[model samples]
Target: MKNVYITRIAKFLPNEPVENEEMEEKLGIINGKASKARRIILRNNQIKTRYYALDKEGNVTHNNAQLVAKAVEGLCDDTFNKSEIELLSCGTSSPDQILPSHAAMVHGFLKSGNLEVNSPSGACCAGMNALKYGYMAVKSDQVKNAVCTGSERTSSWMKSDIFEDEVAHLEAVEQQPILAFNKEFLRWMLSDGAGAVLLESEPNGKTPLKIEWMEGYSYAFELETCMYAGGEKLEDGNLKPWSEYPADVWGKMSLFAMKQDVKLLSENILKKGVASMKLAMEKHNITEDDIEYYLPHISSYYFKENLYKEIENQGLHMPWEKWFLNLQKVGNVGAGSIYLMLEELINSGKLKKGDRIFLQVPESARFAYSYAYLTVV
Candidate 1:
């Protein structure tokens, strides 16, 4: 197989950065009261700033597809223009619509040219899925180059209006003013951003990151849903999607709002992530010693120590200095998180030739993970 190189990396962050204190002002307070989980989540996540695709009046500035189109536009240069693209693979947890795939919307926005496009939908690992698809497409000689993107318009879903009916129902019935922690906490955790990279058979820059190997794993066979949107978890541990329920009750139950099983996530996320990494390492016949820069896409800094403990227990312990993360600066952009981190690291002028960058992407949506090895050359 031919090697796939990540040539040009770019990101599109809409509007100015929103501080921790300014979140509720833009997202609005749920139940007309401040979220009890916001402060704690912000403190633990250590995210000082994040971007939103909405204005102060809570109006959308860019849709998910537009965000991706903007990011893809940033990839164009004298060396590679939009017309030169042969494949466009996009991934997102939040799409503007469900019918036309995310990639089609992106292509429509770009008006770059008619090309093969795909959209992989999920949580964090969706971005890796998009990258892997493009990587394989180039490596298999199906195309000379491919453009892959990951983006999220999460702010639209996190706005308080989405939960008004559910919060109002709770206030009317339970007399409690606070929204559910599962849904409310995410409002503080997610942000909006889009990132893109041009993958080619040859390196475009002096220090292009070459994809060595990519692997994805799913523990969904053993674990139930840990995080979800547009659905409800039934008593039997199965999800009831938004379409299954009545249209009127969707707002009442906040069926379209994102939710998580916090306890389940804490118990299984790190444990399963490292366990699956071990399996991937075995298959690749590589060890931690083979990597120089470790980039793990984590939603919160609170999980940093816990994740390290899990790896240490498995004898795959990596020193903190080897770890690189920007969650504190970018918050969590879900599927786009890793792409933003990679864009920053690659443009940071830190990586040199022959460096090995290892990516660990874990999605709590259902305990799926994606790992990739990239070598700077």
Candidate 2:
């Protein structure tokens, strides 16, 4: 089997950092109720806050594609020139416009010199999907080097009207805005950032991280249960969250979405991947004990808890403290989470040559991707 290796990885966040307390204050939640509620949620998730890009005026910035291109340029630098790159894939949720594709803009900015480019817009797994595609292209010898980038600028999507109304709702009840915050209705944890990774075909006479194999499985549930972009109309004239009228009045959509994806992964991806890994380990006369690092997608604090439990149930021992705790600082960068974590590990000297690493990705779109790599040995 041919080997595809990661040559470089880099991540960039805006200079401004926002804490939960500051957000509450900005939202006019003066009472202690909001602060208390935020405390409870933060305590449970071990995330105090997240970062976002801000303009010179100290307002949340709204340039998603531009920042992403800048980050990719920084990663490419002297190591790999634009002409050397055969493919450029960008994974992002926040696009300036729906037309022409964000990838086109990024490609133009990088001056990729006619390199093939693809821009994918999945909810949170966009980054991982981009990486997976790049791996396939290189493994198939369609490209010698590929660049995958994950970038998000949620501030662009911020609905100031909705925010004001939500805050008003809390004020009416004499409670803090945090007290009125609902996980299902409001997404307070998401922030803004961009990350990039460079992948190159292994060079002769030089050892590189071996990409053993990868598999992806997706299952779609009813549209009413988990609407990605559109939904039914609501009684009021105002459009639903994403410009569509709201339907499914019960608001159990997110719950159903989570259940469907979890079920699909548990049945189709995890069971088979775990079994295959076991078989491959035995075929190579290796054991779980031989693995040194594990990287899994970090979506939420609750997600990490459930994932860790599953890992334990599978009898896999991991260095949770070193390998899994980085999410606190970065939050979730969508598909770039695992790759960013790997970069951190390598830079910190925790990931060494010959170490075995497993990467598991669970996307919000009811898809799961798994990949295994053995450090250059």
| Candidate number with greatest TM-score | 1
Please, what's the RMSD in Å of model 2?
6.2
Most lDDT-accurate candidate: 1
lDDT of 2 by residue, 1-377 (tens): 34688777777777666676665443333222444455655665565656666653446554777777777876755656767778988887666677889889888766768889888777566776788788888888888878888877765334233244445565667775542233222234556777787777774222346666555544433112221332322345222453332443223222111122233333444443344444545555655566677676655575665655555667655557524446677765555566667667657765556777766655544333444454654
What are the clashing pairs of model 1? Answer: none
Model 1, 1-377: lDDT tens digits are 78899988999999999999899999987756777788988888899999999998889999999999999999998877899999999999998888899999999998988799999999999999999999999999999999999889999898889888987888779777567788877888999999999999988775688999999999999999999998999989999999899898999899989898999999999999999999988898887788888999999999999999999998886888889999888879999999999999988889988999999999999899999999999
Query: Candidate 1: misplaced stretches above 4 Å?
Result: 174-177
TM-score, one value per model:
0.98, 0.74
lDDT of each: 0.91, 0.59
Minimal lDDT window, size 10, model 2: 252-261
